[model samples]
Target: MFSSHSKLYRHASPGVQEELLALTSRLRSVITAQGVVRRTTAAIERSQWLAPAEWSALQLEAMRALALHAGRRVPYYREMFARLGIDPRRWRSLDDLTEIPVLTKDEVIAAGERLLAEGGPWLRFKGSTSGTTGRAMAGWRDRASIAFEQAFVERQARWAGYRRGERRAWLRGDPVVPSRQADGTLWRMNRAENMLMLSSYHLTPQNGAGYIEALEKFDPVMIQAYPSSVGYLARWLEEHDRNYRGKSLRGIVTSSETLGEAERRIIARRFGCPVFDWYGAFERVAAIGTCEHGHYHVMEDYGRVEFETNGDGTANLIATGFGNRVMPFLRYRADDRVVLADPGFACPCGRSFRVVERVLGRVDDAIRTPDGRHVVMLDWIFSGLFGLVEAQVVQERLDEVCIRIVAGPEFGHREEQALLLRARDRLGAQVIVRIERVAQIARTRNGKFRQIVSRLSGSNETDV
Candidate 1:
């Protein structure tokens, strides 16, 4: 019933392992609540008294729990805590978190071997991420850590109008293709719900039509996808004067990448459904997400986020996963930046989670010029090029950039020329700009399509 090439067997065979994982997940989904209301009520309760002070307190408590567990079981953390003169019991606040040094991608890569060698108590499994600067790193996640992740995921789904067993389509980091059985019959696994996996990488005009048709056929109550992919589809529909009026879609969920206001508005206008933007990273699992009222709300009660500055006002994001245990990421630099929203902006929806005005782009997405100058305002270039359905900018060298665009037939050459000229005009005369026409652009393994790719190395600093 399974294909020999399928990786579903890595953990266990297709039939048994898939069933067990689904059963366990379903149990977990209901373990906290009989339905979405009960689960959402708990979250609402947590957010009600969730002042900044409470956020600090929870982060400290979470760190203490992690340190205690690590001191007893994980070798690296045990030695590190000992060297820092920290008693697992004495560590009790966010200030104590300051005492613990920050964890970086490089440290994670090096400690991997030690983690594997010890093997018995440590959770050592490979988890890949395109690090803060688009560099790939494969790290380990413990079983305890994974459970914490599952909880956050379930919570997010509930927040966005999803029930435990509700039918929904997940357009995530993986490809959206048909799964087939040994007899070549389309293999469909129904886990008390409906989920159609769509590949974000292949969001071509043709494939997009198929996607729209699939959404209608599956009749999922929700559609979830990366901001770029959703925005691309929105732009396509808008350019063609088409409507993706999927009758069953309650809304569209955009996550993993920064979703600009323009893209959000366009998506909502074309899709005829609400667009919810989620801000999260692989390291922290859950951070901030948009509510129905279209504001980015912080999950402060669940975790803590800190900005590590370079003294000149530039900062790197460091997040502590308050809920995870198997691999509690303590003060791990996320490499994403944000501008904290003022406390006064409250949505009428009454969700207690505070909102952020916007999430700035990733640190790795920035471009540096040859004369030691930096291009900080990415939105400026993006806003300047308005007519594009899809676009990407790759900086191959200090003075060279390759701009790729997938413009509709209605999009005249003059508009495309203007986009190239505007990008070149933004970078000035010294930078060589090459505009290339592409049928498709590449995305990361997790399906994040970066609008800008910077290969210009050596200048690693980013100002938030």
Candidate 2:
């Protein structure tokens, strides 16, 4: 669903808005109802029972098809293949994929439209990456690929005992409720999916009680949210000597940010359910989902994943998605790291998917407020921002936030003001936002870019 911050949704009466959302959900469900998502989900469910040889066979087939498609239709891959004197169409095994150089973010941007398939429907789905590294790239996928990924998401929810149309609550980045809703109704009902959409941006200590009350009343069978947003609710519960009393709640599914152990334990304990952490990126190359046995299983069926040793006790994620063909992501390297399990390690759940100890994904620090509200996911301020190569938020003090930006060609005073206004919407008027122009944002010692940096040393901010 699009953001509720839009003027059309903002002015509608609550009942009318609910009806509109349900209508939107109805239109969207046509993609899944008696359609591609259902068939794909059923096929993947069967794939889980496949032997290692069977799984590899299916993967190789998908890989081979993608290779041939890219070689013929995509100018970028075709030229690269010609330059290397390699014919992907004649390739035999997965090793051949390695012969093609790994694709980097910069290469994708430089190549631009040359990477898209030659036919029509050039870019039905397109969006900007969060650019946590400050080099946000435009990404595109075919409609079929988007529906295929949804099946996998549905399968993950089913792992947590979710059923279609079951009541669920979302506390992720969706701005279902306006940031400045004075009434403290921080949620909206979407009857089409029987979901309660909660606003992550407006969650603060002052309105924590109302959010919890709304959630309890909804009594969702599953709670899908970002770790940061849900962490705030969990900490608020513990601090106030309370626990979530949703009898119907099955489990909490968290994504986007890394789920810290401290946050996970408290969230599970206070919410009276296990916390299932999921990992996926805007690039749609790699995927990791938590299983019934609490093991982090690489979703091998979703995409082909490889680990490049980072030499710091972790490995970088390199993947090639099998679903997308409009812009095939063959050997795309991501800025994420994961901890692999010991060799021969297996899960009790009877799945043969390779297991990982954990994903050391984004560990962005939250920006603390003067009024005790620690605002996480400040990168949302840069969402859809153009003329900006990179951006970082640095908190020097509780009351002031400095936005450091690497300006793009279109970045100017107006763009900076838009950035400031977005920050103010989340940080509130009490906090001062200052934009600082920089030639480039420096990466950490390990050559990793951080979206947010807090100079408050040894800050013992609460569990949230």
Candidate 3:
């Protein structure tokens, strides 16, 4: 959901908000599962078993179709192809993509409507990405693309052994409860999907016991959560000498952030289940997920991934997506990094996808509030904002956080107030926030941007 809809939901009473949230999820399930989703998912499941060469042949065909469509229709790629003297008809292998320049996020922002197809690209819709950088980029998606993406998510769950209608818990960044909510009620049940939509923002060391108690009552078979959000609870369980008492829990699936090995061990130990880490981008240009064997495998059939190797053994991802023709990205450079497996390494699962040794970057520390809230996936606070170029949050004390921002020309007190209100919603109103305007926010030593940072010492993890 976009931030605009979040603002509207914020206006409703908490009781009405829960109903609205469930209604929205129900409606989306109907639309996304309509026609093409099931068929596509079955086809992908079959393709995963094909030989390596056969998989490559399938990807080459999809790349040909998407590239041809872009060249003949989209104004941006049409002009680019014309200037470069390239013929879409003769596009043969994955190597042909190198002829066109690798597109960057800045280029996509500047190109605007030129990136949009002229006509007949069919069923286009707008989408925005507020990733770990805290920068929002607007793009488009088609109906067919949305279905394909949903199929990919379902496939990952299948890999984790989640059957249809199985009870699960969602511990993501969605504000399921109001900020001022007391009484230790942090979750609302979605009977339609058999899901417990838990508020990730309200998780703190103080009232966190209630979360585990509620989960034991629900006894969900699967728990899908963010690494940071669930890690807090996992550590709390260990420190308190309490194991996760959900008798039906079979496994844990984590996504939207990097999973540290230490956190993975603790989570697996506390919950008595394997942790499956999933990696994907908002651009739909790349994907990586763990199999039943706990091995990371890049979903080669989902997208074509090329890598630029760094001196430190990590490789930057360069991708071309098969889905989302409304916003087809050819040779788009996603700054995310990963390490690849050694040659001849293959999974015992018998899938043809490439093995990934490790996924790097995308690690944001949880913003711990004085009230015990461990705030994760802070990209929501930066979504759908205007006149903000870049922003970063730094926590140096238990009760204070500094928000450094590169303000645009239209940024003023109104924008600043909105930000302050958003922070209060997650971190609690009592936490002090000092907004600082700067020309730029410094990147990491690897030229990576981190939006949510924590500087509190001895507060990283528990000693259970």
Give RMSD to native, each candidate: 13.1, 2.5, 2.9
- Give the TM-scores of the predictions, in the order they appear: 0.65, 0.94, 0.93
How many collisions per candidate? 4, 0, 1
The residue-by-residue lDDT of candidate 1 on 1-464, one tens digit each, is 22211355324544554464355446544543344444544664576456667666665776677667766667667778789886857765566567778888667656754432233434344555543333334545554445555555566666677776677876654412222211121122335445655544345455556666666678777777877666767887887889886776777887766677888899888878888777776666347777777777777765766766546444456777665454555677766666666567767777656666777645336455544334433333433233444667778798888877765564578876766666665565667888787787776764556656776665432332
TM-score of 3: 0.93
Model 2, 145-243: lDDT tens per residue? 878889888888988889988999999876666555644577788988889988887767888999899999889999999998899999999999999
What TM value does model 2 have? 0.94
Give the candidates in order of lDDT, highest first. 2, 3, 1
**Residue by residue across 92-208, what tens digits does model 3's lDDT show?**
776776887889988987887788777764556776766766777787877778889988888888888888799999888777777777556788877668899888877777767
lDDT against true structure, model 2: 0.82
Better of 1 and 2 by lDDT: 2
Best by lDDT: 2
